[model samples]
Target chain A: MKKQTCSRILPLVALLWGVGLCACGDSAPELQRYELRLQGTTSRFSTTYLSATAVQVTLGGAPLRTELLPSSQRMNVANATHAHLVAHFWLRPEQVREGALEATVVLDDFGAFEGTDGSAGFVDAREAPLRLKLQGDALERNGRAVIHIDLDRSIGAERQGSRPLLPHLRLVY
Target chain B: MRLKRQWLLLSLLVPSLAAAHDLECEVSINEQSTLVVREYPATLTFRQVVRNIHPTLPSTLQEATDPLLEPLGWSFTPPPPVAIPVNDSRTYEFSVTVESLEDCARIGQVPPSESVEFTDTLQIGWDQGMATCSARVQCVPADTFVCDDTLYVSSSAGTSTELMPLDPTTLATTPVSSSTGFGYDAMGLSHIDGYLYAISNRNLSGDPIPHVVRVDRVGNIEDLGSLPELAGQEWIVGTIMEDGSYVIGSFLGSQWLRLNPVTLEVLGQGTLPTTTPTAWAANPLDNKIYGYQSYLARMSVFDPYTGDFTVFGPVLGNVGIQPCSCAFQQDGTFLLYCYTSDPTVDALFEVDLVNGVATLLGSTPSLAAGDMASCAFPPAQGATPAVRPSGYYMIHEAALERCLASGPVKLGLLPAVVTKEDALRLLWSSPAFTLGGEHRSEEQAARHALARQTLTGVCNQRLFGGTPELQRLLLDTTTTLGRTRAMSRLERHLGEANGRGLDVALPFSLRGRATPSHALEQLQPRSSP
Candidate 1:
């Protein structure tokens, strides 16, 4: 009788453990994958490059900083506009609150994309954080969001012709 | 001395303002081909030079109109950034390439030489102000392009939605199609992606959702989707942007919504600084979205990418005439169509975008006071070269002689053709062909014979001392059958001339191959026979 009771209790405990494992798996939120796309207007990009080398996307108090890979950047000399897929990462749906999330994307302008720019010194730059709106449905449906930064929104004239001072930046998502 | 000092002071206060006004842009086709390979794609390259007309002031080349190359398959490539020094001009080269032609070529398009003329405008934004220059470009190899600036207007009558094809040149309306179940009241029709797109405020499903619908050439409405955020909104202004986005501005509120052309998904929404425009159209040359407020007679520009609205002061000098529908002329002229306070006094006015003046061209067919949309590019030229016979051929002996001279034989009698014989038989069979009397004079008999001959085929007008009326009949004879009959009538009239000394030398140019408008102008005013 004792052996049979022990066997029954062991089988029941094992079943409960398996059920708990399945429940935990169902309760945990699935992460949605997304890509960040950066595009500039063709008219302005033909003159000067958007000197941004890195981007940081922050959501729900957590930030994902990405140094743009060489394969990800397309600062070609072609006088045409292109949408560049710069970064890819995953995010939890819980990170989006109320069907919307405000993303603060920090752009670090290092002026070193393909080493085309001959400038060695830093140009007059502003560290203003660009804010973009990420729609929950957009990510849920398209699995990607775009942030377009206009280089024509520069504030002042270039100090020198070679190192054009890009002071102002506007973000459109 | 006071005037000079005031001028100096003005120059000091507004340096770039005057300099910007001196900036001029000239566009020239550097290279173009008359014959294009129908199977392969072709590219057209042109040069645009921004010259500072002012002898002293330097100007920066700021903004330009990125014209939407028409017929759906064309794309433009703008040159690199341009800058002009003092008294110097900067040249920029641009190219337009035919990306595809399979979709734009319509079925059953006739008269292969399709010619289109559209305006390309460049608005050079200087540091302080702006200057604009425009040039009309005639696109060649027009046979490949079938998409013409065919005007389509929609009605504002509640629940009575109708789309009609409007002739831009004649302002005539013909029914394309009409349907119910969608409320299109106060919505403007916009041509986008080879289809007419409009916003419907009516929630036919009884839900609080407004929908954007597409109307095809045959006027079939396809519901794209419903916009929940735009429910119960009255939008009279709508236009298709360069990025294929449909933007609708509110009629009552200052709100506007940019939507996906295919899905009607709300991509962006913003508020205008002032009241929204009642009429909106994208300039084909620049593809810039411009809005016209009929009540205020003011023009406004909307930047689709940034959601920026800039309104200019009154663009029409005559406030008496209110324009409810706005479109761009083929030459990049801003055209507004409407009437004065009196509904019957409506005409199409060409708005001078820079000076805010409007010149009335001619009367157009009045809509139900609704919005109008047309292709930015004009219909390919030489598409409709239908021959219109001269009405003078019936009355003037010289016209008959001229027609006979051109025939294979220079004889008093016309070469008898089967069509002429058939027409004469048909005329004789009718009771209307009775010779007035045997007592009639030779000229009278000849005129009656001419009338009978004309009535049988297309020229059914009796040239009885009404030259203008005869001219009108000739113009109205737009059918091929009518033209053929009129030609035969000319020959028959010459056959009866009896080789008499031609009284008037009617120019051959006025007879055939002349356009209707050209015929009207060339038919010199003459006393009745």
Candidate 2:
């Protein structure tokens, strides 16, 4: 009688334990989301650097800083991962051109990792150029970033088939 | 035994003409006082093949015809008057009227005293080339450790791939797409426009690639049909052509058939020039197809354009060359590899396309060279002939690396050279019930009963020539065991031993103390038991 009683109660305890194990496996970890807004400027290399020496860049609305672009670029933002950093930038110019700026947003660390392969810690970039344009007095999106490229440009100097050079901006943790 | 008996007769006559034994030719006295020269009967074969092309009599012919005598030169008279009696296809007798032996010599008629003018009767409609098969090998990729799927492999050292299309710094492989139906083989690359091809030996009313299987560039599978000849023959193999056609190796006899790749339609079928080559080499060294007849060990070099063969070789005895495979190169030579199960050794042989002479360049490390695939390449210095694989091999497939939300997921594969990651690989389906496993195009298959299949290179099963009754019995046995859940004991009781007292009802069982073996002795059939 005792053995039977013990056997009957053992199954009940086992079921309870199994339920708790299931809950623990599905528990969620704390997650935090962050975002980085990137801003940049652009200008025609020939028109802007004619009588000048170097270009400059600035974060937010801070003081202007020198910047440089690297070659061997993957030409894409997402594929740039695992690529070596080309070089360091230097601020060389005191004189500034008006309206030569652009902006973009990015999330650094999503706080928590989840799902298979921790892909839960990723983000998908839907923007094609994530680029910008620069103008005197106002920094704007450049290279037909807003409108379709086939529509033809209206503002910059009337050029045959060249797009104005754009600056770089990155958001990192 | 027939061959031995014939050889015995020759040996018995050898003492009369010691030097004549060295001369084996087909010369006869002609009525024009000249000598008539002919090509003698010889055994031609391919490498990796362990059999010989069997010669049957006129009864084996579809319409019962006599064998044709190939005339090579003329001697003694202007060739005797030929007489193949209309209603009788039995014998071929020529009325010779030779004036003098000197006149015959001028026509290259070797006298029977100094040389031999042998006479032989062989079956027509089939090739008489003899050959031996060799082991397989792996070679390519000048230098690399990465894996890649290659498109075609030439007998020479030329490989094609699309590894580095954009960047010159990384793998520089040109993209080779099969979307155009362009295929690679032991011959050069070929393709056809406006048609899909199927290969088979299915023997189906009209199914192509039935017994054999095929895997396309993207790994799509198809079945080829079987043949009607060589009843129950199996292990059919073949390749594709430029005009959406395929040259398939038949199962019953040592011959090749030109068929549609998409529909299993037969355009034409022909035999090889010479039946033999060095080890592991098949013939018909046409622009596209070269195959080895498994049982006959004969290699057929087919020229689909002309529907003819140019040369044949004698059988490769023990110390002779084994023709296993032939991979066409851009130049004149083709990469011919040898495979053997005896020692599990495989080698790469550089075979001269025109001459049919093979030279062993190097060998591959022991592996499963029984059946393999590699991307063909153009010839290179020092690598002009068959180059041995350098250490490791590449991945035998074209693994398309895809970056998913998960890790890198590889899917589609393209043609690439072989190395550590790109070992030569083969793509094919199954031929459990298919035919030649290769068909022509839809237009071709639409005409034949066995169309729409591809002749796969799986020549191991006896699909068409096995005992169906036994197979049915086996199936029934399997089903019965499944139902009863008892499979340990299974035997066929072909009624009890009739002479063994049936059920042992007689006192002392009729024979009194007869043993089981003795009891059945009386029931044994007079002939086979």
Candidate 3:
């Protein structure tokens, strides 16, 4: 009889605790999403080069997440208009000071690393910090980054005699 | 000597009117007449002339051969009709025919006979005179290899099992050999070492047995007997590899059976990466077997040694959807001939290896059930043939690599974060189903099938479309255990990728139970590995 009474009270106590946690939902962190696109330069980023390029999102120079776009997001890299990598990170209400967050999107194009026996790393430039402001749960940024770098035509480089360029990754959030 | 004595006695007995009349005669046989007993039943003719040099002596000539010529079947037709008038010569010809193997061998004996002689008797007004003529006999042997550059085809649609040589330029065909009493369903017509080899489903006795047959140029056939490995399979694809090993494959299954070219013995049998196409021809340029899927409108290259298949993207033209044939053109271009289901739509196409486009060359003869073979090298003509780089294999390999890198994810093998680990685990497993453990093998087979499905999917995407069975294979998931849940979502994504365009949702782990602490913990940087 005593064990049965304890089980009955345990459910009531657990229900009250779940309610208390739900009541403090205002302090919960919400995921902020952003779409990253590559612009500038005459180079066409083929599926192979796009797949080989590693995209990393860092907060205060600390790496938050790293992903290969095609493998991670299943984006159509060959389609120029649809070519873009999506990144996500969670930030608390208090952490969104001044209604903006400064994050650096690093794109490492490994086009030049090809034929280096996997011994070579990134061959091109990294982007500066891009400022992002929250519009609900999504991050919005104005203007795209314009950077000068080598061309990347990895797909037809051999057949077309297109030279392998040190493909630069541009950040447009 | 006895014949000469008889003639002298005849002259002595004839002593009528013992007046001696001047009589001169000469018997001559053409010395340049040669006999070559090449492939039996040979006949050699010898021309003989009897001259009457005595101005008034008219004579009738009688000829007798040496005893050695009796066994050689030497005989005169119409008794030679040797009657010579004054100052004239009577010339007659006789043939020596060799019928059996023994006689042919004797005719070709070493140190050819120098004493093979024939004697002639002349009757001049009851006064007999004799003269003799001698000649040498020489017979050379036949050649073992008869080289031909004619293109050949063995079709299953015709009623005759006779193989035909096809003129690639005009699409004309002439029977290379008489029907060997086998059915016309013989496939895999390949040329190897001056002879045409093919796989016939029916034997000479009309038995439904698959056998290897070698046919010489002049209609003689050497049946190499039944192949036990390919005993029951029908419509087997066959070709000789660059290394000269015979490759027998199946249209429905992936079995690649290699046989020794000379012995017709099994060299090796392994599973191919894909099922054999309807028709196959080895490219002399690369020594790889090229196959065409008339239904799918795609061309694929198969490496016999490596057992790898690199399927080129589908052709971009109106290549027929019926049974067709393929051979390398004289100039080393990929040639295709197809007789469509419509009786009048016979067409030939030249496929561009790099672009995967089929250009219509012209209409072809009725090749509804045709498969072709040719010598890799163009016909021996003026100078050494300069072969430019086809670069076909390189294009195929590049397409295969591209498909492998993106096809799986594009086909929803790894659509979401939850199924990524499982999909990758299954993708990395062995494709062979013959592994020992049952459960493990089933899992491996599932992975293998998925990998194949992915390969077909990517190649099909690059192509116009493909066989229903290929599409069914790509969509089939009954055996992929626990994947039913993921398949529905995969189908949605596939539709999105195929027609609806871009996918709006990202593949992430945010939907399920996520606390603020868990979310913040993901953002925190960890120590470098």
Task: Find the candidate with the highest lDDT and give its number.
Answer: 1
State the weakest 10-residue window (summed lDDT) of model 2 chain B: B452-461
> Model 3, residue B500: what's the lDDT?
13
> Residue B65 in model 1: shift from native, Å?
59
CAPRI-style docking class of model 3 based on DockQ:
incorrect
What's the TM-score, to 2 decimals, of chain B in model 1? 0.42
Cα lDDT of model 1 by residue, B375-468, tens digit: 6643312122122122222222333334334332111232231232222222222111122212223343344334333332233112112122
Better of 1 and 2 by TM-score: 1
How do the candidates rank by TM-score, highest first? 3, 1, 2
B186-205: candidate 2 lDDT, tens digit per residue: 22111221111222223323
| Interface RMSD, per-candidate values to 1 decimal | 32.7, 40.1, 39.2
| lDDT of candidates 1 onward, in order | 0.47, 0.25, 0.43
Q: Estimate, for each residue in B184-215, the C-alpha lDDT of model 3 and write its tens digit.
A: 33243333244456666655566566667665
- What is model 2's C-alpha RMSD? 42.2
lDDT of 1 by residue, A32-128 (tens): 5577665644243333323233456555445543333332322321223665665665555555553334454433221211112422211222223
Q: List the residue pairs that clash in candidate 3.
A: none
Best by TM-score: 3
Instruction: Estimate the TM-score for candidate 2.
Output: 0.24
DockQ score of each predicted structure, in the order shown: 0.00, 0.00, 0.00
Off by over 4 Å in 1: A1-173, B1-146, B185-192, B313-315, B319-323, B329-331, B377-529
